[model samples]
Target chain A: MYVAVKGGERAIDNAHAWLAEDRRGDTTVAELSVPQIREQLALAVNRVMAEGSLYDPDLAALAIKQARGDLIEAVFLIRAYRTTLPRFGTSIPVDTARMRVDRRISATFKDLPGGQILGPTFDYTHRLLDFKLAAEGAPLAPTPQAAPDMAPVPHVTALLDRDELIEATPDTGEAPPDLTRQPLELPANRALRLQALARADEGFILSLAYSTQRGYGRTHAFVGELRIGAVAVELEIPELGFAITIGEMTLTECETVNQFKGSRTEPPQFTRGYGLVLGQCERKSIAMSLVDRALRWKELGEDFTGAPAQDEEFVLSHADNVQATGFLEHIKLPHYVDFQAELELVRRLRAEALAQTQPSPRAAAE
Target chain B: MSIMDRQNWMGLLARARPADLAALLPDLPQSQWLRPPEVGAVMVQGRTGGSGAPFHLGEITVTRCSLQLTCGTVGHAHVQGRDRDHAHRAALVDALMQTGAAADLQARILAPLARIETDARAARAGRAQATKVDFFTLVRGEDA
Candidate 1:
């Protein structure tokens, strides 16, 4: 049992003041602004927004600044701030089919409709440090091209669907579980699992996905489609009796086709794993898809080979960094009473063991 | 000017930058709040497998308000972010759009905002188009 003792009020206050001072380090230098972080360190802001499960970039940037560049802390700050606000309503599901395509590519097809457009990607860049960037040199502006016709890019998996080569994504028309409002229950549906993976810690999900690639839970996954773009979010107004676009957000979507043989009642077909996340987060979305596929082993009738990724309970329970960090960091708090009790018990047990092992005083004297 | 549907105009208004919308609105009209500008979040949902069942993706901050002009035109606005003034201005525009000022507002406000948005989108699309891969077959002596 933990007991609360309150004597460090002044110390805590002083520490917080010192933390504020340290957070604004080097008074001679100009402090970093939230807008600069939002624009320049965009990927960092994206990660915080995705994991925090909040879509406000300004708030995310402010959290990053207040957290002094610690991303998980920033995410925690956002999550805490999010709970204080009232939920107006839920938006109609965003239509990714109508997304304004920015970067879209497929490994399965060399050339497909809406040819692979590498939008602001660092894929071909060498890992060597650019000293010019470090020296604050402004590079030449990007060369502009004639704008292409705004045609909707069809999914590569849809082509496979035309031939009935891959399993069709079922339109269940079910309302998905809200993981935020309700406690996570085991044996989650595909929608619930996807929602969890979308906001799951990037590093944690990445490692899990990496393990699957390393033969832990091999799925032989292929990147069928990876697209990043902006999509409009719509909400229905009861008074107006129509849905209206409230805002638009950038989303990175990944669909992976995995090899699956026929089951007793099923036929051999390529299965798919999906990942959708807020902002231009390609790596996280890819990682999420791989892990999502691995976790579906049971539903897919594949042997549960006891891989860490296949354990739904284990994966979902520990996937949240906020929960993990809270428990891990709480150990630093005062455990004096518990420690003292353990110390006394340990002393008594050690004394008893020594007394038993050694000769008694009377026996030794005799 | 082509008249826009209620949905289209509302979306354009919501997506417009606060400063841009404010710059366009130089005149004030007498109005009362039916529902004052309030900041809150709306849980955004996404489909499973991109076309499957709907799932809660996350929450986004949105400010919504409803107001009525002295002429009794009621209007509502829901915009992304925590800008109370933006929401108020959008609501006012919604009210004004129903009156005799619809054509004028369309010319002075909505048209320019829509043009700005279109130009921005075209510029982004142009940059992306430049990166489109163009594949060509390499001719060989064996083929020749």
Candidate 2:
């Protein structure tokens, strides 16, 4: 007997029940509070905020909790919700130069105008596990810092330009490309490059950066400066006819100094790769610089080697994790109808092929 | 194939909402489609026979707007009775579902809209049936 399988209401209900049970886990351990997740797992929240493109910490935290600590899933949740809410209006471009510094450092200079302040970084820590954390409660030392409000951070790049060694950074306030609105076309402006870097995958960005360092498409990068801080996002109310501080966003900015390998006719003008993104994502910024350089191969008079990292269309399109996951997982949906059609066609083709190659039983009598 | 019932239709409609929905408005999706918006006809109740004899439906006029997103999402939005937001929201849901918010969307937006639509439809049917009544009269005897 031929039997056809169809998943009805009962199957769906049971599956959902199983899934909920799986999500909850064994009842022995205490369930994590949303606040606790937000406060403690802050970097995760930051990443979610950056990629989710919404600046709400509480909502991101809630999404993280609902996603069971899957940061990507949390980001997806925020993004989905963010799009649905009517876009009232876009805020004015944030000024990174005026950012209230939290963790600021300059790699190009040992001693600059603004001293390097390593606020809170896991860079120097050993990978050894702490047994105390496993046993539940543990005492932690209070954070140390008088680090009050200070003067504006005169960028490390400015220090280099004081001698007139590089080209002056142009202040073109022209509206940069919105990648969300339009398709990513070749020969992108600086705006498009930065946007791609902001949402790019951590590991993938890191690898492309590593490749550049290894001379696959090297751009001789010395992190001219890396700064992480908070900048106020200002919105101009049409009724009031004046701009006001609506909210602030935590951001990481990176500017890399590359050797001015100029063309035959052109002057030896030094260029820089710059990136700015929501939250403290120095790694992403730096990787962004390398990728940024790779994408600007044509502009920089570098040869097109057809690298995946160098491919503008490929990188910009696939940089989004949410898009990548959805298309990949869509295959899980039932394809039985299509599969059956293919099966019948293939069977018929094979039968015809066999018939052509072999003699029929009645052929000898004929 | 199975019988078309209220429960089956409702189940299909409810899938529009997720169990844990988000609070986002879906934007119009884009596509790489070649076709531009052309004048299309909308289905309307038309009496081929009289209303008493049970007639069929006819077609009305509608305009559809479609565009392809950078992501190659061929979004189609048609105003039923000319409601642009309706088509736009449908296309937006189609785009966002491809993203991470599929679950939240189902719970919040889709579920609520489905519920509202179902309720409104039921209300309309009730109002229509209120006026429906059967009447009869007996003939007078002429012998008197």
Candidate 3:
């Protein structure tokens, strides 16, 4: 019974005009430039890029401006823009092992090679507001140190792999299914699941990951290692007969070691859950790893405890904020005709019920 | 030059700042567009456990173009971001690298860009190096 009604052309236009004015906010103040948003509000840009599944900082900044700082709306804008571009090809999987390590740390091991570098993090910063930053002057510069000729840091999991204490991650040598190109299929492979979780909404995944720690779907996970840095992205050039570096991007990676008992066919070994995300999104990456482990219960021969995180369809279907928001927001649109139909039906049913309960005029006279 | 050498120079050109590349190579040799510079995207992939099966992480903007020099040396360039001029300059550099001008271009263009990249990397390394933890244990009075 859904019927289209058209008449708000002028009203809609006026609304949009007002929205634009409000988005600018207080004409007395200076305007916000795209570069300012890109550089100063970097974490917001990172979140938009990660969730939007597009990594153009400029575009993300522009979206943020247009959306008036509504991050999910910014993500929606980026996603819309991304679908219009022609995809050239897929890049060769980036080598994180050779990444220029900016921040590398391990919670499981006290002493590990490539000793823990904190890099530029807010982990130790006090939560109190800095009123000085509210002023326009530049903040104090960070202390510089002599550059060390550092060796390539190896993955912390390599140590556990040496003695077969941790399960080995063998190269599958297969092209993974592109979730963007295909509809989400249930019983998703690890590769497909990881792809979904990488671009999944940060807040949604964070909560799901948090649930696991609260014993809903406990995996007894430990953060094996977390590293964030720039890595070169290489692509195979068919004419050149070899791969060449196209560019580099900042990536945050987390590997979680989860507890596992020996199954009937396999020996006892620590299981691993992996997460890799665009930019320096450490929180999202760590959360992704935990949720990733919880979802692996079936493959690891663990019990299906009916936890929300363990349900693949449930997690993947609802993880996308853009999709969730669109569906949720559509209800605000005019459902007038549908509601009217329901209203008439209910009234008719009510009258019929009353007629059955009470006698008609002719019956009463008889 | 060997394929390895070509790779090194092409990578440098691809990653160079557009303004930097433009400043270095002001005059370009006559060339015809085999494929005009077009902006597109490349789906970047990452592995499952940093070294396992591959999975799609995200897409990055990449501009690509192909061109042929007057001497019949054809070259292709694919660089990240949506700068058509950057891609064109990169392709020109690629074509020039195969010609008699290869050594001159390397000295004038590639060397400076490489230095800039190296300096940036060093600066980033220095900042991270400052934060490397040096752990120590306190000696107990009784044990001492």
Candidate 4:
């Protein structure tokens, strides 16, 4: 009698203990503290916070450490922890207009209200690797800039709106659809688009944005404004009958203006693309804005040409790295039982074909 | 002082994460309502009659609570067969029935199942370590 091997539980336990040991490494070696990770590896932490959609850099850092420096795994960890958390209430939508702008820039207009603040960017850096920095990178000297004490920078979109050139973004007060609760349908709103871009896989969104530039679904985009800074997250307490500032997050907001050739009915308005993220990730924001525009084909009176870029359902559905990685890696699980059934079916089919070519004694009698 | 670093990535998974599925654009059935089960059960592996080796040969009873929210959100709190905190979970679900809280709960409750599964496996491994044996016997010269 053939017996199935059954030690799944034991095998799992042993593997976990081993993993714990591996995570810690040698017992004699000093343990890495969470603070060390948070401060030293701030950028990694920022990416996790951005992608994980949770603003806690400390948690993100801890997650990164526990994940063995695997960002995707860290994102997964954050996602799981976030589920069990006891949420009191929803906060009001953050106003990027009133954001205490640290870094603000516009590619569309150089001499706009907010001239340009490059903030911290690697755009113009040489591509060559610095081997000296491999040992210990020198501390970057902070660039000092005179504060624009007069007032915060006005939005680049505001400039277009000033002239009635671009379409106005209405705050209809209608709550945006929560993509988490509802399954994504074909036609999505601007809110869903923004959310998708915010939590989208950085690389996937980048590639999608790159595709637009390569004429896949060319939408000439000029970065209207990109701003990064901390914004208060105010939550309403029904008991208190007031909103309280619970926390704050550093966010990156990108608004893009595309060339619009109006259709028969609508005016020739400058189409808009918007992207907002958890941290200072300009590329993610720019890409997000482009994808956001690409997704607006239905709203824009544009034809659905069956192109991959134009397919909102396909793009949004496969936009997450966590979901992508999970599903992609889940294939590695044991499928021997299923394989055995398939093997039996194929054998039966081959046997039947062979019998038909040269009838066996039993078959001939039948 | 929350931070994100490469190390933080792994740490994040050390717990659990389900919100990542937002990328998949999962079609979750809309139902904010919750109903604590009058008589519920979970498929928990019952220990073997003895402690020789805890195999997956048997299963035990685990009663759970279920509550249905007004928005049709179903909240289930399964404990070690019976738990009082099911009400807490139900209340959480009721709260989640609100406009935006549903997203939080889906990530907090459902996504951590994988990590819990991993932890359970680890526990079993800890137990198996004791019973791990290397068997051998001295042979008599008579055979030679």
Highest lDDT: which candidate? 3
**Worst 10-residue lDDT window, candidate 2 chain A:** A239-248
Interface Cα RMSD for all candidates?
A: 1.5, 29.4, 1.0, 24.6
Q: What's model 4's TM-score?
A: 0.67
- Model 1 clash pairs are none
Model 1's CAPRI class is medium
Q: Is candidate 1 or candidate 3 better by DockQ?
A: 3
lDDT by residue for model 2 (A1-366), tens: 445777678988999888777767887978778878779888888778767766656677889988878877887897776565433345555667777666677777766765666656676669688677787567777544342435677777777666655545654545556555577786666566656566666666778888878876777888888878766554443543544443345777777888786557766766677666567777877887778767777777688787777777777778877777778888998878878889999999999999998889899679
Give the C-alpha miss distance for residue B118 in model 3, angstroms.
Answer: 0.4
Residue-level lDDT of model 3, residues A3-120, one tens digit each, is 5678999999999999999999999999999999999999999999999998888899999999999999999999999999999899999999999999999999878988888888
Ranking by lDDT: 3, 1, 4, 2
Judged by whole-model lDDT over C-alpha atoms, candidate 4 comes out at 0.60
Model 2 regions more than 4 Å off: A1-7, A146-149, A183-187, A263-266, A362-366, B1-144
Candidate 1 residue lDDT tens string, A177-220: 99988999989988889889888899999999999999989999
Model 4, residue A263: distance off in Å is 4.3
Residue A262, model 4: Cα distance from true site in angstroms: 2.3
The CAPRI-style docking tier of model 3 reads medium
The whole-model lDDT of each prediction reads 0.90, 0.60, 0.91, 0.60
